[model samples]
Target: MSTIENLLPEELLETLRDRAPGYDEENSFFHRDLADLKKLGYLQMLVPTEFGGRGFTLAQASQAQRRLAQAAPATALGINMHHVILGMAYTLWLRGDQRLNWVFEEAMAGEIFAFGISEAGNDAVLFDSVSTARRVTEGYRISGTKIFTSLSPVWTRLMVHAQVEGEDTLVFGFLEREAEGITIKDDWDTLGMRASQSCTTILDEVPLNTERVATHTPLGPNPDPVVWGIFGTFELLLASVYTGIGERAVSLACEIVAKRRSHVKQAPYAHDPDIRWQIASAGILMDGVILQLEKLTADVDALGTDRDPNYGAQWFLHFSGVKGRATEAAKEAVELAVRTTGGAQYFRSSELQRLYRDVLAGLYHPSDNESLHAAYAKALLGPAS
Candidate 1:
């Protein structure tokens, strides 16, 4: 209750089992029950101590995400966007963006923050977004349209990206949501993760003062420290969300098979060895995902607060590929649940449909599959691969 720790990771698994009643017809992003998150301060788990909020560890945050995913897929998504913003923005404000102290201070007081990185031109991290921020008399005039601005509808401060070409200089700066001339466009109707309210952000000649911009990427230490943590958080959350959906599908499978009457063998469908095998296969994949996450978490923790690495992008590459694998595994788990449950579970009331769509959304992260694998392999056996 005092926000000493993440509070829910250990408790949420139980609450999800007891409290989640599948999908309620009236439940959605604007639902009432989600207020439990804010009331309980789960929304500010990663806010820094100096900023007046408790900041949990990477593993704790990851575990909480898994637990939330089990409760309600939509609520989990909405909560995820909030938590990710707090974690990333909190870290940046606390460790890197010293000049932007007021933004950090406001977040500590429970102000919500969101990331607005995806733009109309640059959907992926590797792309050069066309958003331009030219120098004006007062500060800077930013003109751009960013799509998929998650958590913006409800969040207070949004961290945005724009470029500035100085005298022989090109720099990236992080701007605030309240900056003059910035507007949030609520047009997000994605096939999945809809509860996140991922809308478009319009920055039409926004004026940013000296306090709004964070320094170049990797505000902490290395050549690209900022991106490293963001990438890592993205990868871990991918695994956690998928793991949640996988657990849900498996649970539904167990329920249906238990009720099934084994007309062929004169026993319940629960006794069917084939169905059992399918469940076992799904379990195997889930197990694989957990193992990979364990390894990834440990590897990241080992990196510590260190500065630079020659193979700086190694972790980023690993995250992209592993995320793809875990996402596929989660999809398999959901499919197995639907397949083994038969046609009856396909009803409109079934939660499996929503979970199915959520897992599918995990597939499109705009990454390089071959490049990821090749990088990992090259790291192991020289760059020949």
Candidate 2:
């Protein structure tokens, strides 16, 4: 029952906030932040207590992520990759699946896991993979280039997926960082979320042990736990981060207006009707986003062990919908804050300026606008004629 208030206090948040700009400016990973988080046992928040973790639920993780993102969006996002994997394993484990118990054991032993699923031009997402997995003596040899490999600088274990060659199946498993044929290109410079160090990873026949393979399902989406686990945890965690950004933007906006005076009446902009209107609009959007996020997470939590794995479409519909709405609301909130803050937010020194840049990354994550619309269309209108 370690709440975010106890785990990430105001002092720690201020420290993270202080270092965020420096990390962004240097395009460096959040080494110090990562260290502090590890020390706090934040990395094992999702693993069960018996397994040496805090045993927090997905809902708690979402709330904690929101608080963390409010201080440092990039740092929150970088660690989110680790959380997503752990959350996925834990979500399935809760439903009586023991396939990923090793994940918890390794996490308890202090091993860091990074996600390596995203590929260039692979819009099939979890349903398919452009990367090829050739069957070898014992396990499959994964050979493909993965993009947006976050935590590239320090990940100890990487979870990846690839399409098996000559077979209509997809293979998912882990690869050791020290394993051969794994290359991490030092080219993570980006417009925002720079501290994440989400670089490109090239695998040249990296061997994956058969024992480590988590899923070997058919080529397309199915009623497997892996699909729902990944989609549910990824979408909820992603939504939480953007919602945090929106909350912080409004908070900063309020601070900015309270200090700046209106030239027309020499009164603080907080007293101006138009300024209030803008803040109110952003507040309204954020409120709705938070409600949607909470409802979705709660529903996932309440799902019984007998939950139907076949109910994948409804799951995708809600998860992607919330993620899309959260990102859109966050972007609008940031823009509104910038407009109210006037020229001050235009400077690189301003946190709002950084948030404005960082919020743009949300649109590029999984379930993009196009994907969101497509999911909604398929859900409401049935498959296209």
Candidate 3:
């Protein structure tokens, strides 16, 4: 690990985890807890050291998000934006964009940088931006709607993607917190990760100065910027959430199981061998997910701040696979808890049942498992295979 990555003490992380809000069965309440993360510098870990910031590598930042995910998936989702924005802008900065210096400085001064991708009814909004940036005499005019925009409510600055000059080329732009006509719809009700406050955002004629935009052309369609690889940071972040979810599931399941009277109660699940098998199977899944994340993250960190020049299909495939594997494990482990708990799991007061519902919703964050499935299959059938 880099000296910088090692600087964040374990005790501090534990304290942050301890202070994180409990997983509320009601989604919106989880979202209200987002304010706590903003009070900390967790949102700006990516600013360069020259800017008086941590400038953590993708691996280090992913580890932090994943560690936190071990506690609150919802809270992790709320903050993953900072890591993504940092990694993205850090790459641009590496390519000699001095314009990003102020943004880095702002981050060092404790600004939350959010990525306005993932619109409502759309999954891969990063690749396809419905938001368009039209050139004006002064700068540009941006207008459109984005869904699941995390951490923007408390953000002082933002990193947004839109079509520049009404051209096919996609561009990244910065938006101020007090920008005119920037509205947020917090009606995001879902099964999990409710603390994200990932509401829909509407930009109606928001002015963006020329000095505030990045990515004059698409950095995708191959490997120059490794946009998909850049997206790997998010996948890893979600993987951390899964690891945390599994850890919490086991802890909660064991506590409840210990309370059940094995001999007195005529319980079907209490002593069934099948239940034992299910428990063992869930353990295997959790172990596999953790192993994969640890290995991948170690490799990412070893790569340091230099973004890879070539995009390996296998690495990309691994990234796509982890989210599906981890998400499925988290949901399955929680569902197993619900089943083992029996009919009582249905009661309004059942924590196992609440965990099941609340856990599954986070599966939808960033790249949905279903979309990654299709994308993975297409890659295999390509001529390169």
Candidate 4:
């Protein structure tokens, strides 16, 4: 019954916006923001109503993330990892796999989950992993270094995947924070999204209990539910954050141009044709991104409910396209705002400066521009000969 507005009211957003600069300047985690959001039960917003959560669909959650990002992109991005995990579990559940039901239950109990899927040099992503998963008497002992492990400060559980030793299998499992053999490095310095504290995690023979193991699939592209769930939820939510950044940039541009006076013209810069063109162009780019995101998220919700047998065959094309487009749009829109806003935005004190840095981080996320184009090309030309 909780609406997105109720969960993230304007007052909270204003507070987050006020604190954003300090957090970025200090390069510290968004502990206060996380605490406030926790109090609102925002962390468990995706759990179904039967499980004592708001029972929000992915579409609704994506919209909420966009609003949150508009206030503080770093906080929204840091929390997005947890939501991505929840979304994946819900996606799989809707598809009739109950293996991740415990995820929702644990979320209800206030257990925060972090994503540990990225490896230092592993470009294959979900289809392959550089980490090794060795068979043990009880279950599996995974040993490798995971990079970009967001929510490193407060996660109670981490979802990780690794390639099985001497086999063509990739295993997915959850590792507890209290479990031995997990080391979190203190190095998380970055150009943007600093509040995320996405530190590098070293896993030295960490034990995954039998019940903790979630999925086992052959290496490389496959029709596994785990892969589908992660890709769908992650790409959509990540795109939503960048889209929010674009929204913020465009909004600020409008405010600045309307108030900023052009001495020569003796009027607000909004009357200038060039400035109007830049702002309008930004709006045009954002419009396409919003439409793409809405359509894709709605399709995901429908697919989850109806069990479409062929719904996901070419999903990579759409998912990667949205993320690529959104990131590019955010960056371009932020640049437009910066150029039109004049010299003030170049200073570190300017909020637009922080946005520029944060928007840059989107370029490094998975499904980068190259991958996006590749997906589209593959869809048209087939795999490389």
Candidate 5:
């Protein structure tokens, strides 16, 4: 079990932390950070060991992501998009589905994959898409705009999907960054997680050859292994990042309480029972998030190649719960930290203030509270009559 402590040394994390604020303040991409990560072979963490990579499991990768988020939330969140793609491919490979083995091969060859699945108004998730893929001589011509294309600055490949013309299926494929009619719009200005550079990507007749297409699946839910792999990996990794944020918030709160002095008592705020209680509460909330993350990751690894036929629905139920809980826990922990640390934390320069804004982005991700609850209801009580 190669932990993040061994894979990503403390010195690298410290450097990432030092660079994080500057990137956030400038609303720039973490270019240097990405280069360093590549140098350290962090991008190949999910590639199989036989393919000249470390071949880490989901449990190990989740742990690594949690630690990365503690140093730089935006960086971790942005890179997580790439990791999710690889994680899904690796998961399917581990389950005896070698359809996506090329993804691992590409990773070993030093190609970076970015996610391009999000659209402006369509929220049907993996079940539907607004983009259209017109049949072409070689493969398909993808024409649509994708939002929140993380790793926009440096991704060599993009994993995208679109509805096939005159068919009831959607085409999932990878497109080269330099493909014709591809435009990356620099419109990612937001409240927090600014360094992620998750800009809008436009595709106008972007051509993908036959080899680049990964799969063609029917619209809506089905028993597709790829779909389940993606949903599971994405939700779990996203949850892990926010869990890291919560843990960092709790740590910061403890440090503040230990160092700050009470004017009335002329003693450290740590001595104040009320402040101690707040810190303890934050710790407890973060503990729940971390435990859920750990358990879910372990379950994912344990599934191996023997997953049950109905495991997809069960996985969805569990993933939705963990994602929602982790995000909420992170937000609550940051709020408690802000309260315990005083008004200074309200300033723009305060790390807690940045964390406060960053944690809010968690709410916008897929499997949001309403959708998560809906899935849970469907799984628990069965669909409406």
Candidate 6:
């Protein structure tokens, strides 16, 4: 099995890294990177082998994602939307559910999927949604606005969810990006991760034919495989990207320190005990983050969905903790890198500065620091009396 180091061509990563600054500077999408990834068959990496795809396991894909983030965090994050969709489908398929097999078949045929689950003030996560899926003559008419719709510029299909009006059902469906009444607002300007183009998507009575509806389950907690699949794949992959960013930051710090000479000591900064210590600390933290992510991913791929009934909740707790820790590690590593590199790294052009800004975004994803801690506490200590 090819390791993450060799999963993607080195030259491609170099090219993407070289172009990342320009894309960020102009707040443009990484169209070139996306096109290259498509040409390389990365878009269909999760499809089953029978469907002529690489059929990569979740562990393999997560490793590749971490590697990809080392070069370009925004690009890795944007492409993650597609991977999460395919990963979810693959997870379900492994559990003997063929309902989502068509997603793989479509992916192999060159369809790109985008995630459209986030909404304004929807803190219930997957259990509830503000969007309404009104019953229609043919299927359902979905009307809601979704935020953080990553890969908005190029996704061919949007996987979304909405509550059925006057019912206890939450419908999951895939709508074509070009379908009528679907408007994509190009308003994704942010503090970092600019190239992702995760714009706001407004669905105004978007129609979903009977054939397009994927799944319908009662709202709130349930024993649905799709829910577990989404939670497992999304959290792990998100953590992987931030972990990659952390890895890159530490390497850059080491490179910067190795070339500088301390005139007073008449020696390279690399020989300075303080600089060495800082780098060592960052490396140790990053290593822990990477190992945790790898082990969890391996477990998921190995166990599939046939484990104990409590596996889902326990797995989520683990994932939430890892995601929070990985993001924090990446942020700390980037901060240390800036300190090691001196004042010059504060410039807008500095890669470390970009990483610093990018790492802050981790605090905003699902299972935020507070939520993760709450969940962990609830899991271990039980809910407050």
Candidate 2 lDDT over 1-385, as tens digits, reads 6787878889999999999999999999999999999889999999989888898888888999999999999999999999999998987887788899889999989999999999999987888999999999899999999999999999999999999999999999999999999999999989999999999999999999999999888977676787778878999999999999999999999999999998889999999999899999999999999998887787777656554343546788888889999999999999999999889789899999999999999999999999889877877788998
Ten-residue segment with the worst summed lDDT in candidate 5?
303-312
Model 4 poorest 10 in a row by lDDT:
303-312
lDDT value for model 6 = 0.87
Clashing pairs in 5: none
Q: Give the TM-score of candidate 1.
A: 0.81
How good is model 2 by TM-score? 0.97
- Residue 262 of model 5 has an lDDT of 88
State the C-alpha lDDT per candidate: 0.64, 0.91, 0.66, 0.92, 0.89, 0.87
Candidate 6 structure quality by residue, lDDT tens digits, 117-152: 989998767778999999989899999999999999
| Worst window of 10 by summed lDDT in candidate 3 | 1-10
Worst 10-residue stretch by lDDT in candidate 2? 303-312
What are the per-residue Cα lDDT tens digits for candidate 3 across 116-215? 7666664555666778888898788888897777764566666777777646777767888798989987777766566666777899988888888655
Higher-scoring candidate on TM-score, 2 or 5: 2
Among residues 3 or more apart in sequence or in different chains, the pairs in candidate 2 whose N, CA or C atoms overlap within 3 Å are none
TM-score per model over all chains: 0.81, 0.97, 0.81, 0.98, 0.97, 0.96
**What is the overall TM-score of model 5 with all chains considered together?**
0.97
Give a tens-digit lDDT track for model 5, residues 156-264: 9999999999999999999998899999998989999999999999999999889988888999976577777788899999999999999899998888888899899
- Please report, as a residue range, the 10-residue window in candidate 1 with the lowest summed lDDT: 19-28
In model 6, how large is the Cα lDDT of residue 197? 97
- Per-residue alpha-carbon lDDT of model 4 for 1-385, expressed as tens digits? 8999999999999999999999998999999999999999899988988889888889999999999999999999999999999999988877778889989999999999999999977888989999999999999999999999988999999999999899999999999999999999999999999999999999999998889988999988887888888888999999999999999999999998899998998999999999999999999999999999998888888764554535557787778888999999999999999989889789999888999999999999998887778778878898998
